[model samples]
Target chain A: MNTCKRIRQHLELADFMAEDSFSLAIEQHLATCAECRRFQSEMLQLKHLLKTEQRVSAPADFELRLQIQIRRVRAEQRTVWLPWIPTPALSALAVVVVCTVVLSVYTSIPGPTGISQDPTAAHKPTPNSGPVQLVQPKPLKPEPAEGLSLVMAATGSTEPQNRPSPRSNRQHDLNPDKVLVLVRDQNNTENFVTVPTVIFGAQPVINTNAPRTEPADDAQHIF
Target chain B: MSIALSYGIELNLERTIPIESASDHELVAATKEGDELAFQEIVRRYRNPITNFVFRMLNDYDRAVELAQETFLRIYANSGRYEATFSFSTYIYRIATNLAISELRQRKRRQLFSIFTPWKTAPESPEDEQMLDLPDTRPLQDEDLIDRERRLALSKAIKTLPEKYRAALVLRDVEGISYENIAQILDISEGTVKSRINRARNMLREKLQAYL
Candidate 1:
C-alpha cells in the first residue's frame, strides 16, 4: 500500500495495532515517511486529549435539591380535586349523586292535593257530563243456582258505591227466581246490584232497604 | 413512583441489594413500586454522567446542571410508564439529549431576537472609568493561560458543530459508550452513529489543528 493510505489505516486503528503483518507494513511506512508519521502522532494525541477531557462533576447539593424538587412535584400531583378517584371515576360519582338527589326529591314531595286527600278520586265519576260512560250488559234473568248468586254478589260489591239507590217500591217487581238485578242510572250508566230474593207465596220480593228519590234528581232504572 | 406521603414522614428502609450491584431495570422496578431509596440510587448513579454529557453539548455548566436535574425529575415522574424493553441508561440519556436540544433551540431563538434589537450602551461615568483603571497586581503564567485558552477554543469548536454530530461524537469518544448503545440512546442505527462520530471527529480535528 502507499504511504498515505497505510498511514490513514494506522490512524484509524491505532488502538488495535497488535503487530499483525498489515500493521507491520504501516509501521515500516510510518518510519520512512515523516509526514505520515506526523499525521499518526497527531491523531494519537487527539484521541488521548478526547479521552482525558475533564468531566464536570455534579454539584454537591444535587441529590438533596433533586429529592426536594421531586417531593414538591409529587405533592402538587396529590392535591388534585379528588385525590383517590381518577377524573373519569369522579365524574361518574358526581353523576350518580345528582341522579339520586333528583329521584329522592321527586318521591318525597306529596302529589296533587285533591288526589292525595282522596286516593279513590281517580275511580270516582266526575261531575262533568262530557266524558263517555261505558255500560256493562245486564243479565236478563238471574240464575237460581247458589254458586251463581254468590259469584254475582261478590262481583257487584266491587263497583263504585256512589250509584243512586233504587226505589223501595220497585223491589217488589223483581222476579223471585232471579236474586240479582241490573240497575241503570239517570245518566244511562249501567251497574250491577245484588238483591236477596224473598218468596212471598208464589211471587218473589226484593226487600231493598234503600230510600227512593225523585225521578229528576236521582233515578235508578232496574233492567 | 416516589409518593409524597402525608405528614412529611420519610421512610429510610434498608436496601436488600446494594444499589451498584442491582441491574438498572431492577432498580427501575423498585422505583415503580414506590421505593424511595431506589429512586435516590438512580439519581446518584446518573447525575454526574448526565451533567458531563449535557455540559459538553451546551458548553454552559450552569444550564447543563439544571437540565440534568430536569432529566432525573422526568424519569421519576414517568417511572410508572417505564418498560424494561431497553436499558435504563439509554432511556435516561435520551431524555437528557432531548432537553439539551430544546434548550439549544431556545438559545438560537434568543440569539436571533437579540440580533434585531438595538444595542443599548450606558455612558461611562467617572466612577466606572476609575474602576476600569485599577491595576493588576497578580502574576500571570503564560503556560496556564495558554492551556486555558486552548481548552476554551476546543469547547467553542465543539459547540459550533451541528447538534447531531456533536451528540454522537461526545457520546462515543468522551463518554466511551459503544456504538450500539449510542444508537439505542439516540434512536438511530449503529451505522449512522459511526458515520456521524467519524465526521464530527474530522471536523474537530480541522478546527483544533493549531492546538494539535
Candidate 2:
C-alpha cells in the first residue's frame, strides 16, 4: 500500500473495514501508508457529514395513511362474497328470462307459426266423389231381461257389413226377448266371420251439472 | 460417546436457531408467517437507515421517501415468498436501489422529451434560506468559512457524480454498510464495489483539491 496504486486500493479498503474484518495484507499496508490514512480520514469525514445531512423527515400521518389504505384493500377483499350479484350473473339471469318468455309464448300459441288457425285442419279427411254418406251397421235395440228392470243398447256399432257371397253359413239362437247370431262367408278364398250376442245391464248414472248436447242421429264409420 | 452426542445435538440446535443478530432473516421469517405487526416493526427499525441511504443516492428528500415507501410496500407484498437464503436488509435495499434506478431512468426519459435548464438561483424554502444566512457558533473552530466551503464543495462534487458511483459511495461511506453487504445490494462483486468507491472518492478529491 506504500505504492500509489496500492494506497488507492487501501483507501477503498476503509469502506470495507466497518465490520472489523480485513485481510492482513491490507491491514499491514494501512499501518504503514500515510497517504492511505489521509484518504481514509477524508472518506470518514464525508461519510459523517452526509449521514448528518441526509436525514429525511417522513410525513406526519404516513403510518395512519398506510393503515387506512390496507383497511380499504381488506374491505374490498371482503365484498366479493355475494356470487349471484356479479355482472356475469346478470347475463346468466338474462338467458333464463329469455327462455321463460319463449316457453310461455310457445305454450300460448295454438299451432306451428303461421300454418293455420285450426290445429286439426291438416289431418281432416278429403271429401269423396261417390257418396258423402257413411254406411252404418244395424242399430242395436234394447231388450229388457226378466230379472233386470231396464236394458241398455251398446253405444258404438258404426261399421257397415260387407256384401254376402256363395257358400255362407249363418246360425241363429233366439232367446225369450234377445237373439245371438253367427255368420260365416267364403269369398275370394277368405273367411269373414261375425258373432253377435245380446247383453242387458243398467249402468249407474252420474249427474254432472253440465249442458248435454244432443247425440248425432247418423252413426258414422270411424275407419 | 455421550459428550460427542451432546455436542452434535448442540450444533444441530445452533443451526436451527438462525443468526438472530441478522434481524432481516428474523423479520422475513416473521413476515412469511403473515405477521403484519412484526413486519411493521421491521419497517420502523429500518426506515431511518433506508431513508438515509436513498436520500443520499437520489439527492432528493421527497423522491427518496416515496421510493423508500415503495420499496417497503414491495417487500411486504413479497414477504410470503421470501427465502431465508440472503440477509433481509441486503435483499430489501437491493429492491430499493433498483427502484431508485428505475425512477432515475424514467426521469431521464421525461427529460429527454423536455429541455435542460440550469437554475441560476436554487429555490429554497424561507426557513432554509434563513438558515443559510445564519452563522453557526456551536463549534467556533469547525464553523469557519473554510470548513463550510469545504463541506459545500464536497456536497456539490457528490451531486456531480454519476448515479452508480454516487450510490456506491453513499452506501459504503455514508451508510457504513460492510463491503460484502454493499456488494449484495449493488449486485456487484466486492472488488467492483471497492473500485467504484475509490473512483468516486478520487473524483471528489480532484473536484475539491483547493479546499482540501
Using Cα atoms with residue i matched to residue i, what is each candidate's TM-score against the true structure?
0.59, 0.50
**Prediction-by-prediction clash tally:** 0, 0
RMSD in Å for candidate 2, one decimal?
Answer: 17.1
Q: Choose the strongest candidate by DockQ.
A: 1
Best by lDDT: 1
lDDT (10s digit) by residue, model 2, range A65-153: 55665666557657865642567888998999999999999877754222233422322333421111111223323333321111121
Give a tens-digit lDDT track for model 1, residues A40-105. 666666676778788999999999889889989878888863674667998999999999999998
Query: Model 1: per-residue lDDT, tens digit, B1-212?
Result: 44332111139544455556777887787888887877888888999999999999998899999999999999998898899887888899899989998998898898688667676354247643532443333444787775665566577778888999999988888888888889998999988887788678778878777777
DockQ category of candidate 2 = incorrect
Q: What is candidate 2's TM-score against the reference?
A: 0.50
